[model samples]
Target chain A: MTGLLDTLLAGLALGAVYALVALGFVIIFKASHVMNFAHGSMLLLGGYLTAVLHEHLGFAGALAAGVLATAALAGVVDRVLLQRLPQDPRAAHVATIVTIGVDILLVTDLARRIGGDLLSLGDPWGDRVRTFGPVTVPDSRLAAVAVSALVIGAVFALFRYSRWGLSLRCAAEDTEAAALQGIRLGRTRMLAWCLAGALAALAAVFLAAFPATGLERTTGQIALKAFPAAILGGLASPVGALAGSLVIGLTEAFVITYQSDLHVLGDGLSDVAPYVVMVLVLLVRPNGLFGAKGAARV
Target chain B: MSDAAKHLPRLTAAVVPLLVLCALPFYLESYWLRIGLFSMAAAIGAIGLSLLSGTAGQLSMGHAFFLAVGAYGYVWFSGDPGPGLPPVVAMVLAVLLAGAAGGLFSPVAGRVKGMYLGIATLALVFIGHHLMLTLDGVTGGFNGRSVEPMEIGGLVLDSGRDDLVVLGVPFGAEERLWYFGLVLLAFTWFTARGLLRGRPGRALAALRDSETAASVMGVPVARHRSSAFVVSSMYAGLAGVLIALSFRRVVPDHFGLVLSIDYLAMIVIGGLGSVGGAVAGAFFVTALPLVMAKYADQLPLVAAPGSPDGSLGPTEASRYLYGAAIVVILLWAPDGLHGLARRLRSRLRSRLRREPPAPPHGPGPAEPVTPAPTTTAPSVPVKEHTP
Candidate 1:
């Protein structure tokens, strides 16, 4: 019973981060029709940037600087690279790969500069482990869950009723059609990117406090998790991201904890476990747990 | 240089570069020699990716899977000190095995297209990595295996005579590696070119442009698609063989998702579907890192605004270079270096002959990009999804 509770708690905590990342992925994909493979890289950048700032210039300042940097970087991406793409839009294939290249360059740059041994990250809350009966949770984990829930509500509400949200939806639904109806596709996209960047930044800051792993592998691993959650949540659905993330997080935590004895493939199949879930979900429910079948693809 | 050369400009363009490459080992140092061989090994992977992504129009984010197969397949068959088989044969065996693996994995591709396929392939990479790390027998666990230097009967390739003297002129071992690379390249080059020229290439292009039309026209869409995957994997396998043989060892990390992205970058930067593009892209990507690593310390001014050293950190610089180049190439030069080269060559030739640049690139109208469409900017390593 204790193990089950611990596994569930662990799942919810990690899933919170995954869900936030997924929300970020969904926003960019929904608005721009671009998958934004660089989202993970951005998330990592946010974490590291905040850590660097926090270390150098207090917590509030670091948070402000990190958010600003992420938004600025997102805008740069939009204005410089993405803005120039042709409207016919099959170019996403190349675009996706280019993002990968950008990610490699960005992560490599981060790793080279912050060449520390242990996966160092900044957690202002300190690394304090707390327990409740047999089910123990870290201070950082609870904080992450809290932050995730808050952001999810804010983003979900903003998208539901806000005029900007309406414009974003219009742009995503049919860019040309939206343009005809007076929505500035470019502005909408840039704004979505900014919002998504900030969200990813938030995820990064919280994750840093929790995982504390260095940026190198963290970038890739975080990206990998976000992918399953984002896809599982539906490309256009933010709430789906949260739900999908929790499901994936719980699934992984459960497997990691319980299946140690399974020893199916020598080590934990847990490494590729998320991907297994992703593939299975993709096959059975191509649009994701809550994704609209017609609108979402991958 | 006749104004009216009978051959397509591609053939003429390749001739000079080919000759220049063959003689590279003579001029370049051993350090460069190593990079040259590495490029050749990478070219093998790039060519495969070029065919799959560039020509077939399918995005695979799991290209590293095929690379790992080739790297490990050779070891499985020829186990360092176990077989003493010729390196060329080892490469060929690796290629065949990888092709088989590609073929086995082809079923998922049949029913699933676009992002689904990308997801499936992405899963493969993680699975492959897990297998490599966990399986102690085949992959040599985590530390990876250190292969013996390739021996060609009398010659010990890894060490020994660093250069082969002919006509009293010393040619370095790197030069020898280039020769070896060139020979293998010739085979891959011919195979890729043959595909592009033949009915199959046309069919593949047709499938990419419109699957329904091709299927309607009696093209076995599934079969052709699967065959393309198989061929692509074989190319990757050969590339893997080259990589393993060149290093005289293979680490699972070397064939991770990053490697797949590297291969994709080559094809995209070079010009998809053009063998020349694949080769050029491979060289560009391979050489950039070597050059950057060498020059990063020398020229610190090019570092990002925040980099402490006032110069780009070598590894980071290489990645930064890779990202910037990829983004630039994709957005500004969609046609890649091959396309860019063609445009420049044609423009230059037309100016020299006074015939206006032969309509710039192709005769087709450039697609009108609207501001409304979603912009997928970032590059996802193997198994990219953009439907």
Candidate 2:
């Protein structure tokens, strides 16, 4: 019973971090229709910035700088590169492929600079654990949950109340109609990319925090787990992303914890478990759980 | 020009390149031959990817997984502690195995649309990687296994034993594999071109343009989509087999997402839906790193592979070039190298036709009185060039 509770708690923490990353995916896809394949690279870039700068500036100052820099970078990429693409929806795939290219470039440069060394992000939570009744949770895990909840709540509110969010929703609904209504598609997309970038930057801290072996070049790849999370909920729905992330996070955590029993599947099944769950979900729901079936125009 | 006159240029364009490729093995040394071999293998894989991603409008990042299936299938089928089938039979079975794997995934492939399909296929890579790591009996696990050299009626494709000479060049493994790759590539080229020009090709293109419209046009959308996946997997499988043979070894790590991305990059850089473009892109992507490494010291901004920190390595330099190429080409010439080539050829043809009869006694040809409009811009309609 204790083991199950512990597993569930760890899963919740993992899912919270994934929620941050997956939400970013949903926001980007909602606003721009391009699956930012470069999201992992952006996350790594933000984390790298924080790790490198935390020594000079305090951790909080470095974190702010990293978040701002990443957000600005994403916005610039959208405005300068993606905006130049043809407005046709079919061009979305091409833009997606372009992001893969951008990812390769960013990852390559980062990997080269980071080399084989692991760097510390200098987070406040450093392996300290808090006990609740019979359950003990790492401070970093608790911080991840708290931060993600606060940020996600703020984002949801912004979507509900902010003009930019309204414009984004409108643009996603009907680009032509939104343009007619004078909603700037370019600004909405840029803002979405910025928001996603900021979220990814925040997620990176927990990803590289306690229990994780600091920040390595390949830490970006761990963010790939969010792909399944975003897909599980449907690419366009925030609530779906949250639900999907939990499912994926729990699946991963349990799979890893119960590896001995699941030895038939193979070693390190945890890494691939999320993908397996994703495929199963996608098999049943091609558009994902919350993804709407696009009406055929022709 | 008359029909025959028009056919002359196209005929020469095709035959000239074929002749040059056939002649290459005789002239080139072992190092260059190996590069060509790898490029040929990449071309085959890229062409397969082009069919699915380009013509069929399905973006798959699972190509390397199918490739791994083909490679491991051949190895297991022919090696000891397995079926131990004849090499030739094993090769055929391996390709069929890859196609069968595709057929197995058809449930999702048939249902999913473009971007969704791309991410769905990502599952294959991770899952496939895990299986490769765990299935030591078949895949030989992490360290991997040596590929048995192909044999046909006691004539070994591997080196030394057969001791056959062609044109006194000393027929080595590279030389033998060169001809083998050429035959396979030629078959791929002709068949892919035929498919593109035929009815199924039209149906696939229609499906890509719009699914509902294609179904309305009497196309079996799901069947065609699955068939494309099967055929593409077969091509990838064949490429994998050829690659395994060329390497004389197979490792699980070789067929990963990076390999799939490389194929995607090749087709995109070459020009989507263009067979010749895929080949060009494959050769460029596959050979660039090797060539860079060979000339790393001579090239500016590129250092040796393990050079001190901060300096750009050969592999890194090539990656940067291709990554930038993907961005720049998409921005400037979305149609890729094939489109660029077509435009250039059309411009050249127009220039030749418009060359005001060389001034009788002038040392150089006279400039046209009116400013000749640039024909290089993709926007300029190449009406006369279109078939």
Best by lDDT: 2
TM-score of chain B of 1: 0.83
RMSD each, Å: 5.6, 4.0
The positional error of residue A239 in candidate 2, measured at the CA in angstroms, is 2.0
Candidate 2 regions with alpha-carbon error over 4 angstroms: B1-5, B305-307, B353-387
lDDT of 2 by residue, A62-143 (tens): 9999999999999988898878866566657667768887988899999988989898999999989999999999999999
* Candidate 1 chain B least-lDDT 10 residues: B378-387
In terms of docking quality, how is candidate 2 classified?
Answer: medium
Using Cα atoms with residue i matched to residue i, what is each candidate's TM-score against the true structure? 0.86, 0.94
For each candidate in the order shown, give its overall lDDT on alpha carbons: 0.73, 0.87
Per-residue lDDT of candidate 1, residues A1-298 (tens digit): 9888888988898899888778878888777666777887787777777767777777778777877798789877876777776544556656666667667766776666556644445566677888787677778888888888887889888888998999998877777889999988888888888888888888777666754644444653576777777766676788788888888898889888977676866675766788878777766775677876563222
Compared with the real two-chain complex, what DockQ does model 1 have?
0.40
lDDT of 1 at B212: 80
Error of 2 at A215 (Å): 0.5
lDDT of 1 by residue, B1-387 (tens): 675675667687879888998777666678888888888888877887777776677777788999888888777666743464666567578789999989987776554566546656788788888888888677788877765444566675554455558556565445556677788888888888788778888887777777788888878988888888899999888777667777876787777777766777788788767777888899998888888878775665565445565355566666677677787777766657775666565566545544445544554322222111233222222212111
Docking verdict class for candidate 1: acceptable
State iRMS for model 1. 5.9
